[model samples]
Target chain A: MQADQSALQCNACGGLCYFSPERSALECLSCGECYDLGQPDDYLARDEFAHRPDVAEPEDNITPAQRTHQCQNCGGEVLFTGPALSAHCPYCNGPVVLVSGDAGYRTMALIPFRVDAAFAKRLAQKWAASRVACPAGLADVVAQGDVAGLYAPFWTFDSDEVVQYWANFVKPGGKAIRISSTKGQMKIAFDDMLMPASPHVTPLIRDGILHDFDPRDLKPYRAGYLAGFAAERHHQTVAEGIAANSADKDLLIRNHIKYKIDRTGVHGIRYLTDTSGIHYRRILLPVWILHYSYGGHAYKIAVSGIDGRTFGERPFARRRLALYSAAISACVIALGMAIGAAAAF
Target chain B: MLAETSPLFAAAALFGLSTYFGLIPIHKLIQMHEARHELRQGSASRLRRAGGWVVVALWLLTVMWCAVFIGDWWASGDYQAASERAWQRIGILAKLAASAGGVR
Candidate 1:
């Protein structure tokens, strides 16, 4: 348990150290002194699915809260609930890291937070201001709230797929309908099909948050990288992630076959695909979530920490929309009158 | 008089409808792609931005040419000649399509 603690005790002032996103190092909270955590190791990926953890049963979606670890700095027992990888020691305010027993199942990878809290808040404010229906004060409300940086878990699957498809093609002629049948096979290799490893984050939200994230940004996971921010351990295993993403993969393969062989008007398309050479890597992606209330209704905004891309819900003013409608209508009417005058002349 | 030129009006209406329904969305897509480039440094952002701008520029150029043709027709007070010219262009297009076996 002591080995999991990534905090460095300040020699000059005995304060709990936090990972500074700005400097990419550990800094003492009391003295403002920094300590370099050294270089990150190479990320690892495994191709075998059989080597997955035994606890990866279909129903085993919860990380046990009973996993207790003692904080080295304060000697306080820190209880990890759900899939939380790191948390502050309640007694002495020291950071405690919990190593989920499934660490050996897959070599962990993580993209450390590049955008700091202040920048994330600024991004949220800018996004709020750009919203067409946003109330005037919503930007200020979002900017005032603290942005919580989280390292969300994801499973990236690599696979070699073979698809066999058959379809009937039809065309309408001047006097008769023509029908033809065709069959074909396709081979495709997919490098990464990303899937969310936590049930808390939906697939749609995950795609929005990690839209264009490059896997090259990821480094081998170390508790040092997760010192300050919250990290969620992977509760859904490799099998579960694959099951969740298989339908989309199948659709992708079918589309590839369609593009390669058939024209746009193909009908009654059917296919069966076989996937092999399947590999998966478990990774943590950084996101900053901001929550604010407008007219008593709460909304959440998530910004990608790797890049400043923001996504969220914002309240819209009905009056503004009505005004926009009126303006567009007036322009259209004026344009019509001008075009009519031209035709008449 | 409007009923006599209903076909011309229909073509203009179609153009306006397609511009609002189709071209507007494509323009919004260009804006979105450029915005993503500014924010995310994505691998495909640059390519998408360039391609989107080319498409928008081509659409705008076509619209400009149409506006110029209409201005010249109105200036000369030769609306019948302008309509005949449009039909002649469409007839040439039909002949090309028939030669290419696209029109049966």
Candidate 2:
């Protein structure tokens, strides 16, 4: 299939342009011109493929592993390799956005990067410096590493669930404890339960920035959003994403039941859930990943590109911790001796 | 002198044992809390079980130490002296408690 490709260009100088987070617009690097990305088209909005049987199946026009697009501005060829639907033109540094022929599920919407690269790096460094019981100068080591902005693919689901539960409880009686059984049903509606579809995002990273993006801020997917940033294709299928989402929903239902049964001395909980009206959309969320080494150990730090929240692995100062333990032990021993002497008297 | 000092030495030894059995698990809990992000399910569960066992062991050790001390005093026919010392300690504790209560 032939994919339509175009590079955002500056009106004044006709130079290549890229999306600038600070300006929230497509800015030309040559002329420093900022172009407003006008209102997004409703046709490109989310849920276009919702409730469709062929949502997971590849379309007849799906692109192959390797394809080249002629740059509109420089007439140079831009090569997109291995699930990359967009890239910068190597010859002219133009931002190229492929309009169609995306492999797998197409991205419906995205929460664009609000935090720039420099700000993300600062946030990571600050997080490293604030860690307790870590080696000194750790932040300096982390500061030396470059922060890469990535658009990580995720699946957001909306569903309605009916949970029917049977529970037993104990009540105090005059002469004995009384056991009673109660049955009830609960209806729950979940909106935008997000599941990461990218392998690059670890569980810790997902947890740290799980609630960082505001759903209301999600914009219709535009190829210009891929400008000046790397975006990942969704690696997991809809069925796999649905499985993960169901696990989380089950936990939520259990907690809801427990809350409903609180103060009833509840035990022996058994429940069955009926889920329906499941709707999902594929989208991209922004993340900044930084890799750094401290004392021969490599660690990764992830900062939420939406809110700048940071979470990462840190190196512990074992020698300093051992010294602290020895000091604590001596103090405990001295306290023990004093108490023993007092008791003896 | 031996009779008076023996209880103190025993008490100190019990405290030493408590420290040995107690601090290591407590430290493990602290480490778990600090490195919670990196901890896997299997290792975290093992650490929690270790902590629970330490608590149970400490309680049993306390009860056993009291039982051994009282049994030794009873077997040696030193009950009179031990009882007198217990009453004196109780009185001192009561007085300290009263003072603390007044301060509060």
Q: Taking the tens digit of each residue's C-alpha lDDT, what string does model 2 give over A1-345? A: 222125465678977677788988888878898987758564345552454333565432233423545446554333342233444533233455544433545567888888898999999999889876678899999999757667777877777789899887665434344677888999888777666675445555666654455567778866666677766666456677777555545655665676777634566778987777777778888888887877877677888888887877777776555555455544554554444334444
The runs of at least 3 residues in candidate 2 whose Cα sits more than 4 Å from the true structure, single-residue gaps closed, are A1-5, A40-102, A166-184, A263-270, A320-345, B1-104
Interface RMSD (Cα, Å) for model 2: 11.8
As a whole number from 0 to 100, the lDDT of residue A74 in candidate 1 is: 54
Pairs in clash, predicted candidate 1: none
TM-score of chain A of each: 0.72, 0.73
Per-residue lDDT tens digits of candidate 1, residues A114-227? 889899889989988877534677788887755667777778777777888997655434433455678988788877667777655545446556777677777776666766
Location of the lowest summed lDDT over 10 successive residues in candidate 2 chain B: B95-104
